[model samples]
Target: MIDSHIHADTRPYEDFEMMAISGIEKAITCAHDPLPMKSAVVTLEHISRLQKLDVKRAQENGIDLYVAAGIHPRAIPTDYEKVINKLPSILNNPKVVAIGEIGLEKGSKEELKIFKEQIKLADKLKVPVIIHTPRKNKEKVIDTILSLLSENLDESLAVIDHIDDKVVDKVVDRECMLGLTIQPGKLTIDKAITILEEYGVDKFMLNSDMSSAPSDPLSVPKTVHKMRLKDFNDSEIAKVSYKNAEKFFKL
Candidate 1:
């Protein structure tokens, strides 16, 4: 199984140990250069330093971990260009899988501009995108992304992460895979099964999105078990747990 999006800040390289015990084969460790925000302030440089440590930890653990570099919406600020310029080298890393965890948020015009620029860079790099959207403005943000992909839609592989029941329809309608975060309070097993039933399980996938928060890495298996209880067939359950994410991440 491949964990689509995970923050290595809090736990660092411990994921490999969890993967070994849980039978998870691979995990994508997302690295975002934290940006200054209006409400919450963190520096991109600090996050970058943390991710560098994460890469080293993964190497030491002997896990086949993939990393991604991006500027998260909440971290976008005026001085983003300095970090954005460094993205090319980051993407060139042999362990880097995609460019992501980047998208719009409820922020000022300046933030939106920076977000759009990163999207453009992702396009130029020709890699898949992992997007995070606000609950209230998910449709709009997704629409904007689709607009950007109008001409070369097939060239891009995109996953809208942290989707709930409310946004499942838009996700299915767009034919984009949905990334369900198993983090408690962020998403529950009940809602995830509902999405599978509604969206046909073909375009849905699971992600731990595990971070500094109190979350169980076991949530992924728990979600699979919940789908089983809901009468979803083995093949259907496999799609959500492994097939979809495997195809997306090319593992």
Candidate 2:
């Protein structure tokens, strides 16, 4: 199974081995933009370097690795200008599947401007996008993103991640893909399955956004197991756990 969204770049290298052992066969590791906070110092060049190491490490460990490039909402104030200028070349790398982990968080003017720019960049480059929604005022953020994309772009090319029941209906109505992240203090396995059960798994996928924070690397596999226990058939599990992501990201 491909963990459709993960920050494997920030975890210990052994995390890959753990993923393989836990039944995660592949992952799409995202490069976060630099933030003012002490922990966020990733630049485009930094993403490239990490992508190289990550791909090599995944191969050595017998796991497949795909990459996504973008500046996160928190990092916009720090590296937005230079990063945007260089993101085009950075994304040219064959392994980079989308331009994201980018979206609105603080809903600041600059954040919205950069988020729109990255979405445009994804469109210009003919690639998909993975977005991060604001923890606060999430419905407003989702509205802002959909409104921005409704005009010229295909909603299917964008993955509105970090979603919950609050905005799931809006996203589904917009015809965009939904990403459910299973992490501590966020969405859980039970809730994820419940969302799928209510919404049905068409343009949905599950992810273990396990990174530097407190999270479980085995979360994705566990969700898969839990879904089966809930009597989600193999095809349904394959859709949310693997096939949908494969179709969306072309991975």
Candidate 3:
């Protein structure tokens, strides 16, 4: 199975170890360079350094862990140009699979500007994008993406992530693959199956979205188990847990 999205913040390496033990064969580790926050943002430079370390560790352990680099919408600000300029080298990394976890947030105009710039970079590289949509402005983000798709006609393999029941319909309706983050409080496997039944599993995929707070890297299996309880056929469960992600990541 493939985990579509994951961060390095919460118990980073431990999360992948748990996933390997849970039968996940591969995982894509996403990182964003720190932002110049009132405090400090985890910059892309830092993420690059850490990604190399994670890559080495994964190789040593015989686990397939890939890396993706991008500037998240929340990490954008006035000096975002400097961060944007450094993206080429990041995308060129041999282990980097896609340019992602990039998209709009419910922030100021400056943030939107930066987000658009990153989207352009992903387009230029012809790599897939893992979009992070804000809960409130999902419709707007979808519209923006649709516009880009219309113009490019060759829209990258995009994953519109963090989708919940509220926006699942619209997301699936657009024919964009939806990435459901399985967190204890955020979303339950049972509810995700219900959404799949309502929306169909053709464009659906699952991820742990595990963090340090409290999460399970085994969420993919847990979700599969819930699908079984719902009487969803094995083929359908496979599509959500593995097939969809495999096709998207081109694994």
Best model per lDDT: 2
Q: In candidate 1, which residue pairs get closer than 3 Å at backbone N, Cα or C atoms, i.e. clash?
A: none
lDDT of 1 by residue, 108-208 (tens): 57656766677677768767778776656766776665565554434337777888876666657675677888777667877777777866878878878
Per-prediction TM-score, please?
0.83, 0.93, 0.85
The better-scoring model by lDDT among 2 and 3 is 2
lDDT of each: 0.69, 0.81, 0.70
Higher-scoring candidate on lDDT, 1 or 3: 3
- Every candidate's CA RMSD: 3.5, 2.2, 2.9
Model 3 lDDT tens row, 1-251: 77777664444566567677777877777754344532223465556654777766655555577777776776654465666787787767667877677777765566556666776777677777787776677676766756655454245367788788877766576646788888865578877877888878888889887655467778887888778888999888889888888787776
The candidates, ranked best first by TM-score, are 2, 3, 1
What global local distance difference test value does model 1 have?
Answer: 0.69
- Pairs of residues at least 3 apart in sequence or in different chains that clash in candidate 2: 34-75
Each candidate: how many clashes?
A: 0, 1, 7
Q: Write the per-residue lDDT of candidate 2 for residues 57-78, one digit (tens) a residue.
A: 8777767998988888776545
**Candidate 1: residue 242 lDDT (0-100):** 83
Q: Worst 10-residue stretch by lDDT in candidate 1? A: 33-42
**TM-score quality measure for candidate 1:** 0.83
